[model samples]
Target chain A: MANPAYVAVDWGTSSFRLWLIGKDDSILGESRSNEGMTTAAKTGFAEVLASHLAKVNAPENLPVIICGMAGAKQGWIEAGYIDVPASLSSILAGAVAVPGQRRDVRILPGLAQRDQARPDVMRGEETQLLGALGPGSTGSQAVCMPGTHSKWVHVADGRVTAFSSFMTGELFDAISKHTILSHAVAGADQSPADEAAFESAIKAAYEQPAMATNLFFTARSGQLLHGLTAAAAQAKISGTLIGLEIAGAMTNAGSGVSITLVAAGRLQGLYEAAFKALSLSHNTIDADTAVRGGLAAAAKAIWPN
Target chain B: MANPAYVAVDWGTSSFRLWLIGKDDSILGESRSNEGMTTAAKTGFAEVLASHLAKVNAPENLPVIICGMAGAKQGWIEAGYIDVPASLSSILAGAVAVPGQRRDVRILPGLAQRDQARPDVMRGEETQLLGALGPGSTGSQAVCMPGTHSKWVHVADGRVTAFSSFMTGELFDAISKHTILSHAVAGADQSPADEAAFESAIKAAYEQPAMATNLFFTARSGQLLHGLTAAAAQAKISGTLIGLEIAGAMTNAGSGVSITLVAAGRLQGLYEAAFKALSLSHNTIDADTAVRGGLAAAAKAIWPN
Candidate 1:
């Protein structure tokens, strides 16, 4: 194998992950750290990155393939978003050949939708979508990445079509901890929407004619004088909010259409649950391997011998 | 003149106020502190009263009449609540006389509709309602005490006919500070409601087919992509929430009835503006003298000789 020469880094707003591989697509070494795009500015990126290579026993001269928010304007190097109706090669707006570096570094460009209607923008996830689709992976598909600012990406014919972001996690945290429901909830860290309370709250939120603003007070007042349990209050808030999230995302992704859930770990289950709750058919795209697949594809295109 | 007759104490959830009056209904002295029912332990009532007395210059002996949350089950002395079909005088379920006290220390009973059809209860504010409807006061009127735990009391024939609590302020704070709209608003002090935004949001909330949950996310998405201002977002939240509050309160307070907007300050003005924005008719009731009116009424009731 030719001197295990390339690396892939998926750096984002709040996280930084790195992977190293050789010519034959075999893993040579891997390193993932917490010094994401946000913190790297305060602590020099080069210094943190230098220490990362030293610990991993990987040479500093390894050609690096980077995707995600690392190319953000606030990131280490600004790799802007690629406009719509553009391919991976021609759409590489943020990808830059970093000069004066010992190893070749090519950053992947994020996607942007300048459609006068919606006009939403997203970064980092496009490359993953590209990888999920594979070299031959093409045609229209909706990709749902569950997160704090969850994104629903529409891709087809080898390019990003549109995207929309939802502040689901932040909303869940707010309603649960800051709202009147806070008085109703006994504790946090409760989970699994399959619970009786969770199911009940979801059903109530979905079926009740009352608005959320109207129903919210019932959580606290119901507990105060009417005796609603804290756990049940929490479940009501979670169910109501997650139900709203599903509705919002479905509006963005279009109903009764085929969509792919690009999520991994616990988040994968949540997206699946939301889809199931909403009765939407979706195929799960392994988030972990999708990035690796994209990086592998990028290596083939850029470092081809 | 009879010996003072009685001291009337309006001891609420978060506050304590006392009046020492003679049989002729003249105020010899008065005192107040933050030893509210919620903050004080069950055994600390006597001490709180004593501490307030120590700070005031008073006559040798005077009968003391206490009302509000001080009579709650968890209060220093549990005066308990009188059942419905309750008259002001009938509200005197049983006055708890303090042990070894020089004079009568009657802690008045609150009203309870608990375990009833609506299952609601009121700890304090009964005295305020009675005092407002005292012989010296005018015809049947509605008194609105807006706060974290706001109460709207209806007074008729010198009695509190009905009342309802609106969790408006808490809901507003929760939705604004904790929800998706937080992104749109950087930070804002309590200002008069933005009329344009308020009117629009209220209209949207009332007219929209779906509930508050369906409407809230737009506050952020509208701003991020649609360019809605932070202040506008805040107003949108306030309008949507206040509309819901009005809707909720209306459920209890039957419609087409005359509304008394007991407003005195800027905050009151904001509420009035919101009410007016919705084309609702209201007569302003000055809150400045509402408490004093309550105080005077209690003194006269016990001083009759």
Candidate 2:
């Protein structure tokens, strides 16, 4: 195996992923855990990193590049933010080094849209955007990075003009586990998904985003009146949220704006299904790849070989 | 005091309210508790009723007329539902009697809009509608009953034409307590409300209802970037939900439709603020009076003494 060149970490609110990269720009080893910023904050961040680095058998002198909530004020160290409208490469200059560490560990800054009327922020997605679309990429694009807090970025050329975060995924989790709809979706995850119900919900919510809340109610009502299954009920909740997100994202992007969906695993499948249901054409980029690409860019810029 | 004529109870999912009515239609005594449908279902609805009846010192022969989730499938008795395009008075004909009760006791049926595409059901609000608009009221009117699940009823010439239920209050609660915005609204309820923030959010949501979810995120982002107060964050959440509800309610009800706001206390204050912010003219009716009025009409219709 090629000797490890550097370590790249994507530390989110509830998940932690570390990748050991080779000198030839290939992944040499990987480490994954639930000890994200939330957990790491409780159990020392340095201790968590040390354990993960040991697991991956990374070199003692390897430098590290970090992104996501690890850069939050509440995270490992306050990396702060790069406010828009800023060039994608501007983020590279804002990386903050963690003091008192032997290894040259650095955390990348996030992006913040500070318009008083529509203030928004993203902790780790700036790297994903950088990875999906290179620092010097051209053209106007609508990029969607879906997760607990799904972000939609509108880019004009290489500059991120504006972005909005929708509390879709988090709301879904909260509603499914805490609300009356929880009863409607009991055991839904154990069963096969109801794609038909999902598509119908996506279309309805996208067309009438104003009725998003009412649409969520139908998850229970549909089960009461139409004998809808638990799977279908869950699908309705998920679809309504995603559809509302798509509608909000499309509002200022004008007609037929090219969509670049940056997602992975289950979320990617759901968004693709949503786009297909709405007859929307879009390109897909692996979120893991994008984040890794972003971390690699930051690493190369910080330590040119 | 005059002998108790009838007992009125507005039993909901989480609350129970009882009023002992005298022969002259005056409230002889009253009782309130948290033993609503959920608690009643577990501890026994008959026992819960007996405790409340004892507290109010009702006459042994006094008949009870109940409305709300007490008549739900999971309640004391299944009162079923009055399907819409139903007349305001149609609810009276569907009351189901509790078989084992010593005193004459009946629970009013709810309303169900079975449009498969937009299925909806209400257990308690139908009576509020009947009470607020009356069985013989004339002309078109839009009634907004704000609650955990806010109901918007479109009544035309005393007949219930259509309605929609927005998950406004519930969403506000869930978002405030369960989401990241919870931090932003920690001391909101204890502090004086920030009306300006509430009005600003309401206007923004009303203008772009599609951006409802995005608007919710601003609650947290605003706090992070703009030093927003806890009261302001709570107000923003409240205003967004209410504003989205108003927008959805108005979509089908043409321009300048007269609104009747049926609410009580804090909810009444919040909604009144919302209407004022939007510059929408509306008449207000106390929710207590509306539910009582509805039960009275039902009592008179059932027992024409």
Candidate 3:
């Protein structure tokens, strides 16, 4: 086995992932847990990090590079933000060191668009963007990072020109679980996927984005009037939200920028299907790979051997 | 007090209001309670009705006319629906009587838009439409009834042509209480109103309804970047949802249709402000009066002197 060079951690609001990178730029060990910023804040960030490190059998002297909510004001330490329009490489220089530690531990700062009209902030996704496009990518691109808070970033010539965050996944959860539509989507997880319903919903919402909340109502009305299945109702909701997000993102992205989607598992499939339904061509990058690559870049920048 | 002729009840999902009417079309007594359909469903709808009826001093022979969720499948009894495009007078004739009630009790049927593409159902709003427009009214009208599930109805030549339900109020409740935006709007109810924030949100959302979810995020980002007050955050949410609703409603109503707003209290003020912001010419009708007028019309038709 190659000697471990350093440790990389992605500590989010509710999740934590660690990787031990070999000197040869290979993955030597890994650890994953639900002890994210929220949990660590209460359980003690240092204790959580030590336990995860122990599980990975990381060397006692190994330095650590961290990204995401661990750097948030409410996290282990306030790493602050890097204001846009900023170069992807500036992220490496903005890493804040955890004080009085046995070994050096750094947390990367998030990106913030402080424009009064469209103020926006992103933490872990900045790293994902860095890894996906690299620090010196050369073209105009609309990169979509879909999750609880989906981010649509417009990058021009290696700089993040603008970005917007849509509460798509969170809204979906709220609407489905907390609104009247909850009854319309109950037991959808056990049913067959409704591709036709989803495609039709995407088309409708894309065409008339203003009718989003109205479109959400169709989940219940469709069931009442047309005997729409629970699965179909769920598909309608997911499609409408995704379609509305795409429409909003496209308006900000302009006409000629190429689209890049960074997502994994279910969100990736859902977004890919939405883009296909809307007839929008796009490329995909695995989210896990992108974030890991981003952490690796930060580690290398901080500890060049 | 004049002798009671009949009882009229507006029973909704979470609220109940009852009025005792005299032979001369005067209100003799009134009662209000929070024991709406949901609570009544669990605690016994019949007992709830009796208690409210007793409070209003409704006589044993006085017939009761009811509307709203009390007529839903999950309410006191299923009053069913009158499919649209329907005539306003048809609702008056479709009241379903409680089979075993000692007093002559009837629940008005809701309107169902059974269009295969956009199926929708409304329980109590049809009565409000009837009262607001009457059975003999004329011309194109776009009636906006804002609430937890706001209803937008298009009536032409005294006929209900089309209608839609937007989950605006319910969404506001959910997003404020269950999403990340909750933190941005905590203690908003106790703070001063932010009319400027509200108007700006309305205009922005009216212009680009697709950006709603993104706009919702501004509550948090604005707070972080601009020190926006909790009240402003709340107002922004209200304006965005209402603006999206208005835009969608207008699309269904077409151009040059006169807008009639039937709402009471806070929602009325918010929607009126939105209309003013959008420069939409509209007339306001007190929602309480409209529903009472509707129930009275139903009572008069059912039991002539």
- In the predicted model 2, the residue pairs found to clash are none
Quote the lDDT for B281 in model 1: 79
DockQ (Cα-based) per candidate? 0.19, 0.83, 0.87
For residues A84-126, what per-residue lDDT tens digits would candidate 1 score against the true structure?
7566554334467755667787777776655542345556777
lDDT agreement of model 3 with the native: 0.92
Candidate 1 residue B165 Cα shift, in angstroms, is 7.3
Candidate 3 docking: what grade?
Answer: high
- Alpha-carbon DockQ of candidate 3: 0.87
> Which of the numbered candidates is closest to the native, going by highest DockQ?
3
Q: Give per-residue CA lDDT, model 3, range A55-98, as digits (tens).
A: 99999999999999999989999999999999999998999999
Clashing pairs in 3: none
- TM-score for chain A, candidates 1 onward in order: 0.85, 0.98, 0.98
TM-score of candidate 1 chain B vs. the reference:
0.78
Q: Which TM-score does chain B of candidate 2 obtain?
A: 0.98
DockQ computed for model 1 against the true two-chain complex using alpha carbons: 0.19
The interface root-mean-square deviations, each candidate in sequence, come to 4.9, 0.8, 0.7
lDDT of each: 0.64, 0.92, 0.92
Chain B TM-score, structure 3: 0.98
